[model samples]
Target: MHARIADRGRLRKVSTRLVHEHQVIAVDALTVSDMVKNHRLARAISDASWRERRGMLKNILAAGPAES
Candidate 1:
């Protein structure tokens, strides 16, 4: 009975870690999508005679610090 309880505790910890990891992965995917969308939008605007669009993108990109 004691061994079973210990196993349950370990399983719970593992499950928690797995859930957190999945959340992080989801957030990362969202960030990547946002970045790609931003780039495309910026490029489209730049192509459409908006010279300031690239500068806007640079400014926006500067806000997102590199993640470890």
Candidate 2:
């Protein structure tokens, strides 16, 4: 239950980031956000809370690429 809640919060955070960063984003739903955010949040939390921050970031950095 706690993990589910944290995942939900992470998804919301990612959706906001996407919309705020990409003005033309059309966030129809959060299913997309779930996958994307999971990868990101996992990476961020791992880095911040673990000693392998750089390794975690390098591994997950390509999870989201900037649009051209």
Candidate 3:
């Protein structure tokens, strides 16, 4: 539980920094559901948490520039 919380905080910080550093962020179109169907890659994909990070990026971008 604690680890998950820490990981989320780190992901948010990283996402914020990336947004601040780059004007445009491009990501590949990935069908995560299909990708997760493959047992071998499922764990790796979930561990990477790409979906959550992408959502974070979108939310941060929509929120506009962060207060200094």
lDDT of model 2 at position 17 = 58
TM-score of each: 0.33, 0.37, 0.85
For each candidate in the order shown, give its overall lDDT on alpha carbons. Answer: 0.42, 0.46, 0.91
Report the Cα lDDT for candidate 1: 0.42
**Which is the winner by lDDT between candidate 1 and candidate 2?**
2
List where candidate 2 sits over 4 angstroms from the true fold. Answer: 26-68
lDDT, model 3, position 22:
92
RMSD of model 1 against the true structure:
19.4
Residue-level lDDT tens digits of model 1 in 1-68: 99756755555454444444553322111333344467657665434422233333334344443410
What local lDDT score does residue 67 receive in model 1, on the 0 to 100 scale?
18
Q: Is candidate 1 or candidate 2 better by TM-score?
A: 2
Top candidate on TM-score is: 3
In the range 1-68, model 3's lDDT, one tens digit per residue, is 99999999999999999999998899898988899999998999989999899999989988989541
Tell me the lDDT of candidate 2: 0.46
Which is the better candidate, 1 or 3, if ranked by TM-score? 3
Query: Where in model 3 is the C-alpha error above 4 Å?
Result: none
Q: Candidate 1, residue 40: CA error in Å?
A: 55
Error of 1 at 55 (Å): 50
